[model samples]
Target: MSFDDVLQRGEDELLSTRPRHSLSWILASQFTASTVTAFSKLILTAFYNVELKGLNHLDNAFQYAKDNNRAILTIANHMSTCDDPMLFACLPWRYFFNYDDIRWGLAASNVCFTNKISSAFFSLGRILPCERFGRGPFQPSIDACIRLLSPDNSLNLQKFTLPPPILRNKPSWVHIFPEGFVCQLKSPHENSMRYFRWGTARLVLEPTIAPVVVPIFADGFEKIRPEEIDMKTDYLTPSNIGSTITVNIGKAIDDNVIKSFRDEWKNLCNKYPNKDNNDDLSDELKFGSEARDLRSRVCDYLREQVAQLRLQNGFKEEDPRFKDVNFWKRYTLSRGNSDPDIQFVGLNWAIKEYQRHVKLYNDKGEVIGEGKSERPSNL
Candidate 1:
């Protein structure tokens, strides 16, 4: 078998299990995270200057989660593929506001969980791998996310025995990028932070969960490594070293914000009685007008908060980069690094696996079962 086949088999095996972390694993991961943070501080301080601000906000948010037994849903802009690690490096783990370090996050399966090695690191970090797109009609990743955020029902004592109180009572801090994809900074809208997906807003309004939403404004990572630059080659190169990045945790969306959203949802529900059940409100719908309107309004409010934060962070709209689509390209070209070759080991491996799967299953243009009637093909 080819190396790609091996990676595919490993990826498949990892995704088969549900996402959960043992208490011992969580503690070990926290220790690793703390070590990474310390190393990042030391190296970045000596080589590339690092500045961390608005940590008090993170403290307050974590404190709130601890007090309320509620989960924390942090919505941040997706600036770079390494934002996850950057967040891990910058956030405090042990010293002050200690327990704030323990957190869980979602990572794209195709990109982040392609092979056993990467899977080990991400799983230890408490990351749940999600498929960006599934081959079949239904998306397993979306279903996993919904199940994760939805409330737990453990009414049956015999059927379900919850974990220990310490583990059970721990608040979940889920980090999400509402932008859906990494901002390429290729268009004006992308540069201005105008495009935001409705996933975060919908989760906030979920009746069963209704997690407190926190907006995070991140800056300067682009300076360290622009999207046009290759992640493996151009990022952190000699020329790009010593650049700075900032992550500012904003205040959580309080009760007033939730109340406003709830009021709007109620009004829309009253106007269109049957539309409350629909969740896909990305576009206007004739039948589900209430869900559509509520989604739009909630998304608008959230985006506005992010936009205000960008402005406050000194990202001027009149900047030439916003108007110039080839701004980063021009910068990269002028810097004399024209080699477009980039390599991401995990993503490349995952693509190879996906290709192999498609070739095997989709030879006849439509996917078909492979072996026998008695045992169905899992893929």
Candidate 2:
């Protein structure tokens, strides 16, 4: 077999036991997750004046998902690198005891899996290394999430048969930062969030059963680990220790809404049956224009859900321009040239270079042209 065949075989085997860590790994992961949870609680309680609202909403969603054997997908904004594992500290202690009940999160592979030691550590913590700017949402890690959410559903990207029935029985929980980047606005009270990535849409559309979707809005984490910190040496150190961290958990998205959205996606797939197939490629890539349109729609709706939570918490409505990717790309590039924060200089440059070559698409999904000369008017 060719090298490509070997890689394909490996991926198949990995997905066969999707999200199920080995005995040793599970034990290690449980220990790591528990320790982190305890540490997070201590730090937040001791150093920060934490205000967590809507715990009952989270409790209701967790219980409903557990009772019905449904997968849970918790979506939140990414304000700082520590937004996760730290944000989860708000959950009650009972959540820490059951390893299965804990969340499996996606961390940027470039940042979290830079070396073998960090890779192993993060993996044991139930964190999946995702290629945020590389292979992107279509990579195997995203597929692993899909399989975990809906093992019975066969994806277009599947290269082998489904996993064992036993493995498919238990539903898992997944938490994603739909914004895909740590976005610190001009002020803490600013309600703006970056555009929701299409990966989040895949988590919702591809699942056989719609995962219970819960939106969370967190503020003050930006101060805990601001982007201005020196990425080289200050990673372990927390800044603004006494900053107030407010966490708000919104009610789960209504089941009927998710069902209707899935149905709409299904209709689109049926309308463009052959658009997702590739004869030369072993695994199908769902890059059809119709699929992209559906994904965009889903992402917009999901962003709105999170935005609503922000508004409910007394923040003003976000600027209409915040939903545009180009707007943020321009903003980042401009800041990279002037910002004194050296830590994010490289990241901002990468965004700048990416935007330079990015194509501009029209409403019909045609690439009308590429590259814009003018900056966004609001910027």
Candidate 3:
């Protein structure tokens, strides 16, 4: 299938085709992720001390979660594949910080659902797989997430009181990595943060659950696990096991900002709103430029927050490449080892090797399939 076909297939099939949730699988995955996190922390402590810079921000977030103030969306930078599990590991384990029913996230389909095993593992880990770099909107996945995080279904309306009763809806939180893909740590562009994809902006602006976005900046995971990490060469490799990670959790983006973005988006849509639900994608393409302007209003704001957090944490600002027309092309050319020729020459080999090591590709180099195809479940 062509890349466009793959993207269409994801929009059509990903959420619907997911396997039915198994309670046993969910519990096992949680236990395993927790264990792996514990091991990672143990290994990391020997190298560098773990420091959290913005405790007050986190404390306030915890309060929001406890009180069920609003749906929480934690947006963080994607520096390493280990980031998800590491976030859980670094924070104190509390009932409010539960991952099973309370927290969920979107995972890259290619990376997380390479096979039935991986699919089940990530699915149980509360990750909903979506096309990562594919062209089309990951519609089903996005809609599903919006539904999962809808305030009405996920939170207990009751106010917090002494000896808080077991919450009914579980008060959920969904984590998002706006950068879309993991950028190389040593890339020249590493001085500044990468531009965020507009999908997240769409999610936040579309209303289902207007989440309070909490921005987090993390550094040093790239140091601990190299950017070109492979299961065989680096997963078990201990070269930089002791590297320390610094996480700065900034204050939640103002609710008024969300409202403003919503207003801007609604105004844009009003100009050429979809009259029929049949061609959502076509309608978007027909008015692509306008759609982008609408998306940018939210995407830029979120990225600016992340960029500010990075600067506050001592990282220098690099050029904002997103403003350039050739940014992606430049980013591709930048990927490689120190030697430009060798980096280009060995790029395919390196990618294939990494895929093989991670079981994303079989021994014969065939892509692994996510279980059987099906339609997304109804909300």
Global lDDT of each model?
0.52, 0.69, 0.59
Cα-based lDDT at residue 57, candidate 3: 83
Q: Which scores higher on lDDT, 2 or 3?
A: 2
Sliding window of 10 residues with minimal summed lDDT for model 3: 159-168
* Candidate 2 lDDT (Cα, 0 to 1): 0.69
User: 171-288, model 1: which lDDT tens digit per residue?
Assistant: 4566777655565443333335424544455456643345567788786655555655554556555336767676766777776887778666656544443343333221232226
Q: Estimate TM-scores for all models.
A: 0.65, 0.79, 0.74
lDDT of 2 by residue, 139-170 (tens): 66766676567534323335544453223235
Candidate 2 has its poorest 10 consecutive residues by lDDT at: 1-10
Q: Over the full model, what C-alpha lDDT does candidate 1 score relative to the true structure?
A: 0.52
Ranking by lDDT: 2, 3, 1
After superposition, candidate 2 runs with Cα above 4 Å error = 1-21, 151-169, 188-191, 274-285, 329-379
User: Cα miss at 67, model 2 (Å)?
Assistant: 2.8
